[model samples]
Target: MDAPQEARDADVSAIAALDEPTRRRLYDHVVRQSDPVSRDEAATALGLARQTAAFHLDRLADESLLDVVYERRSGRAGPGAGRPAKLYRRSAKQVAVSLPDRRYELAGRLLAQAVEESAATGEPVRTVLHRKAEELGTQLGEQDDNTGVLDLLERYGFEPRREGDAITLANCPFHALARAHTETVCGMNLHLLRGMLHGLGEETLTARLAPTPDRCCVRLDPGA
Candidate 1:
């Protein structure tokens, strides 16, 4: 189970940018500051040559690990401010690569939405959860133009594997949550996948609860 290929590749590239010792040092120094760090300031702090610091800092900026902003440290307006010293700060972007790929944020979003709606409408929490999950799945399927069933499954980290005519998910993206709240989460997953199948107009496969010790609670079976 992994993230989307483009995201995974970009993350790998960004992480690889930190492999160089000098570049890593420059990045660490820049991010630790409350404000952006100037090239000269970083060089002086790290005991590196000014040119060497600039080179590595630029590299980090290219990887999007750092953001570059031009500012005049001299506190001058339109006068001889000296071309606005290039400054480096940690980028607002966050990158995390998890083995077996988890998306707790996605689960949290669904659960939060369920709670809010339930509180607002006085509906049962479980009913709202299942409804929200199904809605999300429908949206995902509607937005998908080219992707098929298996492709969509893999993209979301279900780790789908075909066993004979049916496909069983090898990993659940919400594995931990499902473990803690079996009935609720599993029912939500079943409705979500059923919505997916319906939205995708998949007539040959059926989504059903088929829990096992090693795989996801929901499975895609061929026909009934």
Candidate 2:
């Protein structure tokens, strides 16, 4: 329903498309070529039947792992010229998957925004970073549906686990960056969760920095 989920599903589908040997072979050959490949050429190069290659190439294009383009092989452009040949090439879409999920791109965007805005407004980078991260978290919270805070947290790869009345995040979505830049990143994370709760209209839980082994630096405590 959300972007992360949608992306994961698409990437999984694309990866699954390659699990078939013939499809994978066609995909590899197409990408390695300097130009888009025609079905006949692909089949000849791979020593596969034309029908077999065409089927696999179509499958790759369906999954968006390959892009299809129609171009005439002949240099002539007259009425008598044959129709354009359908060709296959690599798609520009990027695919990534992590065991525990990660949001490095999100952090990078926040950090970049902080630096650029700090330069423009003469505000401290740290101040801008926190503001931007919180704004983003709020935006995430404001998306469609009335999902619970736990659900929202999990969706964002926080891996939130309940401990009595409190919540501990078992995984940090920005783990590597947070480890490299603890103070700045942890502060950004704290404000992010704070704004998330604010946007979700959650008043009973407080997000605080409570670093622990093998978990996030921020913890959600219940009540005022």
Candidate 3:
């Protein structure tokens, strides 16, 4: 089943309300859990007392960022068991926030520029985009597995869309930066992707800047 849209929106609002430290702790806890975490486990992982963990967990639950999936043994289950321990997991709906919103707006402008430039030059935008996408995909493929590459990309705000033998970056994480300084930002993205790919054991990838009237940027490719 899917979450109701209102509930999803509420979660986003709640996350936006949290302070950075609390938000970081919450995000880290959610990402690290392979399964629902018991209150005790969360406390231990965060080096907090059980009561303290419970407070934050409950707050997160109220915001719908977490869902109580089930009850579990507190390791003190007995013939006369007291309250059952609650296990918490991240909700299917995730909170979304664009920190420093100006940046995102800027990124949109930059992308528009790139698109416009391509159009003016009489080049097929899709063709140029696909070439760039392929370069990015090859760079990501250098990783041992798709998950590792995806994780790296996520940190940079580029979510990957995997197709049969290729991957497309669904979003540009640095939209604001890219738009404001196309050459610099695009080059940086290329360099960052190159380093990340190389660290994952790929040694035959290259990135080159391709200028379009709308946007000037680099494209990545597998070395011949």
- Candidate order by lDDT, decreasing, is 2, 1, 3
Tens-digit lDDT string for candidate 2 (7-113): 89899899988999989889989999999999999999999999999999999998899999999899778898899999999999887788798889988999999
The reply for model 3, stretches above 4 Å from the true place, is: 1-12, 18-20, 74-82, 97-224
- For all predicted structures, in order, the TM-scores are 0.92, 0.93, 0.36
Instruction: Provide the overall lDDT of each model, using Cα atoms, as 2-decimal numbers.
Output: 0.87, 0.91, 0.59
Write one digit per residue (lDDT tens) for candidate 1, span 2-48. 33678877888888899898999998888889999998999999999
lDDT of 2: 0.91
**Tens digit of lDDT per residue, candidate 3, span 1-224?**
12233544575678664655754595568657798888788888778888877887888777776888765465566676667768888777645666322225333444465478678887765444444444554555554454465465545455555544434455555665767776656755565565566555555544455543332244344562
Ranking by TM-score: 2, 1, 3
Worst lDDT 10-window in candidate 3:
99-108
RMSD of each: 2.2, 1.6, 15.3
Clashing pairs in 1: none
Weakest 10 consecutive residues of candidate 1 by summed lDDT: 1-10
**Would you list the clashing residue pairs of candidate 2?**
none
Model 1 residue runs over 4 Å out of place are: 1-3
Give candidate 1's TM-score.
Answer: 0.92
